[model samples]
Target: MMDMRDIWIVIIALGIGTFAIRFSFLGLMTGRRFPDWTMRLLRYVPVAVMPGLVAPLVVWPAATDGDFDPARIGAALVALLIGAGTRNTLGAIFGGLATLYLLLWLL
Candidate 1:
């Protein structure tokens, strides 16, 4: 357990750090245009970030206590296939969600 004062200090430090990270971009890059290469790289940020954020959950979900669950894997595969084939983000998300629920209910 942490002391109340220590908790407050940690909270304040985290807040300041988060603000600094965000301000670094929104403050300094307000008027400047990024180079073409930088823009091209940034365009793939979502494609890179989504998988990074979701892969762990799909592979080792907390609900399953890190056990391998076919439903989640199947849902991920369905989402990937739909997204790749249709290039539809919303459709892929809904399809994945539906498949997850259906598989969980069935399995």
Candidate 2:
């Protein structure tokens, strides 16, 4: 068991590390320009990250004990279709949520 003092030390250390990381981006990079290639790659960061963040949850949801869920898969497909067809993020999210709820209710 960790003592309260040890917990506080860990918390403070993590906070400082996080702050330093953010400050390195904002403070250290002030007035600096990234290479064109870097900028272009950065623009796709969200596109690359979203799937990584969501794929595991959809593929093996904890609620299903890491099993695949059909409703979740359907929702992901609907969201992908909506987003790709209309290029509307919010619409895709709402469409996905609606599909998920409808499928869950029906199944």
Top candidate by lDDT: 1
Considering every candidate listed, which one attains the maximal TM-score? 1
- Cα deviation in Å at residue 49, candidate 1? 0.8
Candidate 1 per-residue lDDT, tens place, 42-94, comes to: 88887788789879999899999999999999999999999899988788889
Runs of candidate 2 with Cα error greater than 4 angstroms are 3-12
Candidate 2 per-residue lDDT, tens place, 1-107, comes to 99999999999999999999989887898899988999999988877787888889899898899887999999999999998999887898899999999999999
lDDT of 2 at 30: 85
Clashing pairs in 1: none
lDDT (Cα, 0-100) at 94 in candidate 1? 97
TM-score of 2: 0.80
For each candidate in turn, the TM-score is 0.83, 0.80
The residue pairs in collision within model 2 are: none
Error of 2 at 94 (Å): 2.6
